[model samples]
Target: MTAAPAFPPLVEAYLADLEHALAASEPRERAETLAAVREHAAESLALHGSDDAGARRVLDELGPVDAIAAASTPAAPAAAGAPAAPAATPAADVWLVVLAVASLALFVVPLVAAAAVIWAVVRLRAGVGNRRVQTLALAVGTVSLVGAAALYVSHVLAG
Candidate 1:
């Protein structure tokens, strides 16, 4: 493979500073920012001439490393009354509700009810889902499982 083009010492120092500033960012974010900046520097240096003056001009356009790092970091929650992004519910939580309802409808089958109960318990332990929905699902699933067990016992006794 061809060797990478050598950057001037000034450009190298700026990149080092930027990398240090980004140390606390997510790995993917840090990598992406570094790569983008490196490419921009290369392109700018080629166009402006690869000298100390050109490196300074490119770094100036990119702004201070601290500023870039702060921008890369996630923002704090919006102040009260500011529009907030909606919390995303996981799909498994949605499925938990559906399975709970299905367990109620199919409570005659012990296996279906048992499956729903297991899923509800697992999700509850994982600390996910809407609070009310999780409670309802667990309650419904447990009741349905109990009913199915009772029905199974009765059938065995009778037959």
Candidate 2:
């Protein structure tokens, strides 16, 4: 197996600082940000030739770790005693609900409904959507899937 590319000391130190700076971010967001930044640094190193000078250049282009962390982090609540803001419903959640509802048409168009059910299940598993919406999608999608399967089995047995 090929060895993993090694970063210069400067790049490694920058990554360490970045990790510390991102400590307050959501775990998923932190991991994603770090991974993307690491990949970019690797690409930059490859382009510039892996060395302290190249790493310095890459870090310069990236700016300070604190600035990067600030850009990635969500804004703080306006007041210390104020309630945290509710997360907005993601677009994917909206689509999941649409697909789950559309699954009701399974009796008339099994393929479309099947696709909808599949999409709903995938989105629900990702756990990225609002809880209430995800629950609705899962419930509706399950019912449709079961109904479609029953209808298919009955038709097959009848013929």
lDDT of each: 0.84, 0.82
lDDT (tens digit, per residue) of candidate 2 on 58-136: 9998899989899786646558998878889989888877877888865455665667667766776776678788778
TM-scores of the candidates in the order shown: 0.46, 0.49
Best by lDDT: 1
State the weakest 10-residue window (summed lDDT) of model 1: 73-82
Those runs of model 1 whose alpha carbons end farther than 4 Å from true positions after fitting are 1-76, 82-86, 157-159
Model 1, C-alpha of 4: deviation from truth (Å): 44
| lDDT score, candidate 2 | 0.82
Tens digit per residue, CA lDDT, model 1, 36-135: 9998988999999899899889988889989999989653454777888877777877888888889889998767777777887777787767766777
lDDT of 1: 0.84
lDDT of 1 at 8: 86
